[model samples]
Target: MLNPQWLRSFAALIEQGSFTRCAEYLDLTQAAVSQHVQKLEERLGPLLIRRPRQLELTPAGHALLEYCEEVSAADQRLNKRLSEHDDKHGEISLICPGSIGLALYPMLLNLQQTNPGLIVRQRFAPDKEVLEGVLENRFELGLATLKPDDPRLLVSRFTEEPLELIAPVSERVEGWEDLKRIGFIDHPDGRAMSSRLLSRYFPEAPGIGSLPCHGFTNQIGLILEPVARGLGFTVLPRSARLAFQRPESIQVIEGPRLVEDTLWLIHRAEWPLSTRAKLVVKTLKAQIEGLSLRNHACRRA
Candidate 1:
């Protein structure tokens, strides 16, 4: 078994991604940090730290972090329970991706309006990194769009965001092949999502050269501005269209079957959820379920 003290140092190192920074922040010598990690490896019977160019966590290191987070959460709950003599009010930390943050954050703030005792800490991350932060005890909850089939993650289906291929109606495009002519626009993460989306449609893994596109932009919001200005067509979540503030800026291609991103509310299954966390989860479920495609624009905003 790894010592809790050692686990603390390990998590700190992993978060900082290096021993020197971890040692400096934790007020421990670099040698001492390295020793703690070596001793931990001795207990684990294998190298958990990959100390090549940068501080990379070996697969074992990742597994240990997950275990440490569970223990840490349990310890926190115990501390809270023992101090139950105090007031019931406490803070709830949350991490979410772009779409949900813009949409649900306001409603969540309103939940605490009548009861000012509740505290909330919100953090924004992309879809994939949000889950990693949650599993590592960085946040109590994460709102994400993609969910892997991991039993250790408890996921609640909160919202279904419709995906659409939006284009300037003046572009004189009608169907999928028109995209071939205009060259599909790329968002910041579109290279990755586009590969995933294409693989789902063509499982044979067609060569990228066979169906090539032009120009990649790292910003999703920027991609839309160009598209509205007659640059090129792009695929985006329907909720994002609310930014136009006018009907003619874009047109949504309907019924041709674009990718659908189902948003899930994710939290570690092993962590003991607090009362505030549970209440927020329930309220989010109720609110998202009550919202239909029409109300999606409202929720995203």
Candidate 2:
């Protein structure tokens, strides 16, 4: 491989039009410049034709010069981009579970609206997909309900969302019998969430599979639609429940024990987050905290 210093010297020699002038420009002795050119020729062969008045470039020299120019230009562009990298701009690619996405997507859009230069690309996925996307570099950030065990991931608790048992406003949920009678509106996470919350509050309740499936929808936004229409009850994170279109139509059944899922934020452990990503993370945390506070206040009232 040709040394970059040799290439720099060669480019300078051509630009300055003399070995002496090039050496002066580069703050090196003329011998050093000559040696640089000699080494380059040894690696790449016949780069320059010596002449009495002026040095002329051979075909190989011309090619090397062009390559040097391209390298220099690319270096300049990279430097400029790095210098300009700040919290206000750039793209943040993130993948997260659908429940958080339901609440976070709109807030991220609002952040983009306020910072026009910041571009947000968000995907709704399950915990497995979220972990995979981050590990594969498909996304710069990820949010998952389960903490990944992979050593390549840098994980931190972002927030905890309470899992709520939601039913049509008219349904009175008193115990296990009430949920069985109301039936179950199952989504992708409906069974798992129901099992965790139910087993804590209603220890005698049979496994979630025994409940009659009143409806099923994979779309997070529409998961609560059945419950809102008085079709059945379902379990969901507070974020999803808050994002439902008809919040007044469904009620969060107060249980003796509160169940919450900890949302973990993950990224590549080897790479530091860009300024723009840090900004996005900060904004997301603030918004999620506010949501939690508001929900808690409402529950207290």
Candidate 3:
């Protein structure tokens, strides 16, 4: 079995670039840190390092650093798991976009109410950050619109959230011409969503940047505020539209059906998710299905 203590010392030394500093951080003597590295090297082969005055890593050391960090993180997670003595109660860490998290909050609350022993810890971030959190094992799962490009991640199609063109309640939108005239308020995902929307509805329209962009904001929940005040129109996912502060102040424009963003649940492929994590995933899947069914019924009615 691999020694987590030795791996921790190796990683700390690489980060600090000195046995003395690493020892100080770990509350161990400098000699202890040196011995830890020597023991690790004996077992894992030479993690080559060149030292004159300052420390420098060889190619082998550079490669080993990534694995060591991963192992150290895994050890930390394992320790936390062991501390939770009750198998019936555990924590699930999740990361998702702000808008999606808002949309799912009610269902999450209901799940928690039903199973009081299960704890769900959630953080809202941009899609990129959410994916990074999952890859780093900081979160057990991530809900994101972007597909995972890394082979190390396992992604499952969560839901296809339809995108809608929205404008202030006072404005009347007929089609693409009105959009061109009114201009747009850009969000973080605005450019990409605009590209896909124009491609689907206005095939011959100019490039996304050619359109008048009033301003840009990275906050999804706040992106529609300007649009609602009649500053401009914007395309946002259904979840974001619902989460907007003034949903009644804005209305979805009637136009050709546009593209939708697919939210996928992403996680590290090799990590075995805890039972609470699995339960949260199942609950989310059911909630999405129910939401879709409700929307479909509303459309029919």
Candidate 4:
């Protein structure tokens, strides 16, 4: 009998490209991931994986990948259908940007409180990682600022949040000179967003080279702190502003209002979402809509 556990490890290894990364993604030891692949090879003949320079799946390994994916998809579908009749709601896993997750977490908590049977797990990941997580069945759904080009993933507009250039309350930003003097606090999406905003708003400076960055942080929540302490300015979405604990410490710098960033909900096109997962998605959509409306009202007021 084929072990689903081993197949899962193999699939992760294939997607992640390295046993170490696959093990990290799957929360398994490196030795364990290797062992799982070895077991599969033992059962279904040699599944040679090229190593040393780079890892490449052998012909057998590639063939096994298709079978494993199909089997996993079928199993998930069957399990989803079976669980519909059960009294308890199954788990729902989601990956989203820190900003979106911060804004939507309250609604999720309220949902779990009302429906005790449902359990929701949310993790903050970069846009790229979120897309990969949903594609690999590691997450049921994902929210991201950027959509992947892959046709296999279904993308839908979630909501648009206003982006603002923020600086310490003490600093003043008027033109290129002021911006260059203040510097920038780089975050995960900072470079891309900053570049686009600069190109549109500040025509004088062509690229990011004109505005130097003092430091960088992968953690979105922490990105604002440095700015608050008068370190450097950063551009962030409205949701991020709402999530920031001390908004009073920083001020929105007066500048050209660039286009807002649209957050997208993404999932694998082929995979069927479980009933509980579907419910979570619905809740998230409604909450996001309400948030957009509120943001609009705030802007008008």
Clashes of each: 2, 0, 0, 0
Arranged by lDDT with the best first, the candidates are 2, 4, 3, 1
Models sorted by TM-score, best on top: 2, 4, 3, 1
Listing every candidate in turn, what is its Cα RMSD in Å to the true structure after a full C-alpha superposition?
12.4, 8.6, 8.8, 11.7
Q: Pull out the clashing pairs in model 4.
A: none
Give every collision pair in model 1: 103-300, 188-218
**lDDT of all predictions:** 0.70, 0.89, 0.81, 0.83
Better of 1 and 2 by TM-score: 2
Off by over 4 Å in 1: 1-88, 192-221, 243-247, 293-301
Model 4 lDDT tens row, 114-201: 8887777989998888988988888888988886778988888887767788889889888778878888999888988787667777
Every model's TM-score? 0.59, 0.73, 0.70, 0.70
In candidate 3, list every pair of residues with a backbone clash. none
Measured by lDDT, the strongest candidate is: 2
Q: Could you tell me which residue pairs clash in candidate 2? A: none
- Runs in model 2 with CA error above 4 Å? 1-84
Whichever of 3 and 4 has more TM-score, that candidate is 4
TM-score for predicted model 4 compared with the true structure: 0.70
Tens-digit per-residue lDDT, 1-301, candidate 1: 6687788888888888888899998999999898988898887755454657576666777788888899899999887656433323666678886555655677678777755877778876787788888888778788787775667788887777666667777777654456666666776555555565555544564523344466666553466776777667766666565445555887876543456678888888985677778787788667756655446556458
Candidate 1 vs candidate 4: which has greater TM-score?
4
Question: Taking the tens digit of each residue's C-alpha lDDT, what string does model 3 give over 1-301?
Answer: 7677887898999888788899999999999998988897787777855567577766667777888877878877797777454434767678998778888877777877887876778898988899889888888889988887888899889888888878888888876677778888988778888788767877777767777888778887788888878889888878788777777889887556646789998988986667667777888888888887897788679
Q: Quick one: how many clashes does candidate 4 have? A: 0
